[model samples]
Target: MSVTGAITSGDASLLPGKRDEDWRWTDLRGLIRQIPAASPQGAAWAWESPLAQAGGEVVDVVNGRGRSDLDVPAGGEALVAWRFLSTDGAGAHNAELWVSVGEGGKLTLVESYEGRGAGYLANTTVNIRLAKGAKVERIVFADDHAEGVSVVDASVELAPEAAYAQTVLTHGARRQRIETRVAHPGAGAELRLDGAYLLEGQHNADLTTVVEHLGVDGTTSQLTKGVVRDQSRGVFQGRIVVAEGADRTDARMGHHALILSDRAEIDAKPELLIFADDVQCAHGNTIGALDEDALFYAQQRGMPAEVARALLTHAFVGEVIDRIEHETVREAAAGWAGQRLEL
Candidate 1:
């Protein structure tokens, strides 16, 4: 199939944009002039990662193809690191990733997307399935090269007694959107989704997620934070649903953003749909600038205004970046966040 045919629902030639409520802020159709064709097989490639682990399995997907090699462990634990890279110039690159965890299995998966481009577009789709009694911790990071545009869509399903947690960190690009859809169908299942974005320059970033609770005693929690500067824009749209019979469901969603420049903008929408009587669901959103009082206090202690601002901004985003379990990954994210702030 052609790259466009594989990524789009019906018409590969058309792209979603402001006409669609889900894409009101980031319009791929208007922003992207042309979608690049898939690179031919056998294109020379090389990948380098800063979060390399000693015993972890690493899978690299370049352009649009990769090795889907994964062994199911009988028991104990497994770690897989999936890396996505695109250097296809002005053309569009497409990639797909799938992960499955068996019953009574424990897995830690890390997926990161980075590209080197002058004006290329990259699209990726990820799907994950968790069996009964399975537990998983997944981390995702997106940092596109200069003037790159990327769109990532992910879906996850959980079985009875399964647990899943995911964290995402994005430094933004010319345009980027990371959308996730999750379903909890098994009783007593739990899900945690958290993300943070550090945007600067003219970059644009959007994080959209929809979660459904379809079983009894299912729980979900989502928290997202963003820091925007210059003329950049950031968006977060989160929705949670509790089915009619999904009793004892507990879900909460929150999004907070910090706007550093008067020209910067942040848009957030958090929604909840509850049909069950015995359910506890709540959501909140907040957008504001840095605390002037805190900045003043830091300056009083003999710190420059710029230093104080950078320090405060770092602390704002550290809450989410620190949640990454892997030490290397967590530290690398922190470093990236700090560097983005020019601290």
Candidate 2:
């Protein structure tokens, strides 16, 4: 539940830090000596989302304040664009959102975190519940200020034959983490988790996830990639657990990253713990710099040095962007990443 986020309880000691297994790489408890005051309410937070004009009902939360409930009835379908925007005040705030889907329901949830100003702390938690035969596709875009700190936590519960697919794209901030925990009932239910983070300057981004198999016949596939430059840092931690009776469970996890600058850093840990038989599980992790051979090959083709590097980086992160299920949102996400990649 606590994923290195600033403690809204105003008790700095409650913040998660290096002592927590899931948060050892991120030390929020030591980062904040005092919880900041709540951000001012009713501020002039006005902005328009690019996806809003395309389609979908717009649910906006400014400075951690606003409407936060989205529910779909049985056999129904919906499209929603959930946006969280912060103010210029260097304060602390938190928001909670609940999403429920009935049997046979489908939802496309496009979430975004747009933070403004510097030296602010924010936390957000989203709880999702899916009935039998339900489906949910979530796409997140997070662009936080270089000096801001934030954490986003998600807890998911799925019924039999349910499917939850999510892809997160973020240009991290001073201390930004997105943590997700999923309970897979393992009755033909499925899960797909993917992420891509591009951080520059002194920014930091952490993507942590845990998946637990409660029954039989569940599957999970996860892939995460990142590119850090200019002394930035990126973290990825994924753990999958299969219970004793969770048979026929198939799961795979992979994380890869690129370090463009000598001072940049990336920490990755992928683990799979199986207590059941007849299950297939594996994990892979890699951290390195740009492929010099590929860079040389690109330069041989007459591409400028900077242009070639940018092109390669863009293509590297493109795999994650291309996995977005929605067409319009996919294009929008590509453009957003393209601008950041300077491609």
Candidate 3:
């Protein structure tokens, strides 16, 4: 399969604007300018993922184009499609995966991104709907090359008493962003978002989330943590909005980042917009270097300096991993983090 297309003029317009309130801090134009024209490349490389045969709905987007080899679950259905067009110096390639969970159904959807060409622009969108009392666990892994620009847009709607959980893991990329918007339109909905990013070199990764409490007695929680080394940069912006009619809404948002080098950077913003007087909402964000006191304590106890640093870094990210309800996934994620932090 060859994944290449024309270069659309004014494609930058399709990309998010910096003037937009949500992307004010990020330079979208500058980033898009760095991407070269897309070209079709031969599909000579392949990846084997445990998620490939996990049995629900599987969608693969390789190098800004969609793949047609997909298998739906026995009792599930999927809508798969692709969109490609050119604008100017840039282009837009979107692979959409939509899944509908039947009543009291249990499903797992996994979307993975892997790019081949360097300096190519890629954008993807995923939409999911869970029926009443249904349960869905979605996992997104962005293991793109170190020289590609990628963005993922995910929107989910939860039915009454439905349960939804998502885990996002990203490695280093030239520039990467993942945005998730979740709405609890039905009463007593439960939603949780957990994410982790491992960035090094000059790579950049951002995870932004907006969760809305629109129904009475709904609950939502989000925990995002990241580790940036060298001159890499990471950003986490999360907002929880509670409607006036959502009297019994409960929501919490937390983000933390660990800066490993003097040149590394992290920008964190956690906001809560509440309109219901009876709702309980809170948000917290923290960005700083490793804890010197704890480091000194470990060093005094005869631990090597490098070993102490790794221990502290692990503890910082462990809080986010602990929130993963699935034991197997949580252990695998933790192991991946441990190997990445090896010093």
Candidate 4:
């Protein structure tokens, strides 16, 4: 079935586009050419995780289906790998996952969306629930087909004293959007969200998130960064809400981007809504090119112009990249960033 046919059975009359405030920067209807039929499950895709060193369980999801052969440990620490395999022709793939963490359990999850070929689409939905005192670390990475489109939506709920941390790295495709929504309903919860994007050629990448603080003494911090070149485009939108009676809530969000080429574009929107008088919430957004002075200093040290440029670009987004807890993932992200910058 086509994308229209699959979505028409739902509530919305039209696909989200420029008319919707949340989707204004992204026009999904215009980007998707034709959605192909559901792909048949095939061989398992090859994937590796550094978290395996910690004896963490690994679960793989190929295409839109989960691999039942591997076992997922119920308690303690584990790693779940969400993979989207590539298809041959025009088509769409969808995946929905639900994750629940037991009390005081800790888990590390990775969502990796990638594939080969052209003119395909991928859609994913993720839901996570954390019991009291649980802790979770989530990493998201996307490097899809050059001519493909991808969309992802993730929602999370945290109980009292629970903690959730996330890090994202992406090499954008033709059209891509990854959005997340999180809610804290219990006291003393904490959240940390961080993401980075590297876009080249004519690719487009968007990261949008909404965090709601609904309990007393909740805390949240968010940081996002991007680097766009070769007429590519990057977008970031983050919103934080401190509901009424959610006293002592502290939330802060910051977004920054680097425009490597004159034709490249970057857009950022950070919003905060607070109804409680005892809350502290703030947001910051910035978009600009590399500092000429910094680049010149590196070149003066005998570094080639291209190498200097790469160094400066890496430093710009390294803050978010270095925050990743997985050593293997961190190396992969750094390598991707270097390749994207042509360093």
Answer with 1 or 2, whichever has the higher TM-score: 2
Q: What is candidate 4's lDDT per residue for 39-127, written digit by digit as tens?
A: 66655545654433434455556566674222223356666665656655535667777888888888777777876668766777788
TM-score of each: 0.92, 0.96, 0.84, 0.91
RMSD of 4: 3.0
lDDT of 3 by residue, 1-343 (tens): 0111212443454455466667755556646643354545323243354333333333344444555333334345443222222122333354556666776776655556666556666666667778888777766667666776777777888999889988887875787888999988738789989888888998888898998888789888888888898999888889888887888888877787888899988888788888888878887788778889999999999999999998788888888777766555566567667877884
RMSD of each: 2.5, 1.7, 5.0, 3.0
Candidate 1 lDDT by residue in tens digits, 55-157? 5787878776786545445355888888777764535667787778888888888888877666767788888888888888888878787588788888899
Best by TM-score: 2
Off by over 4 Å in 4: 1-14, 48-55, 67-75
Q: Which sections of candidate 1 miss by over 4 Å?
A: 1-13, 40-49, 69-71, 74-76, 88-90
Model 2, span 254-298: residue lDDT tens = 898999999999998888889999899999898888889999999
Model 3 reaches what TM-score against the true structure?
A: 0.84
Clashes of each: 1, 0, 7, 1
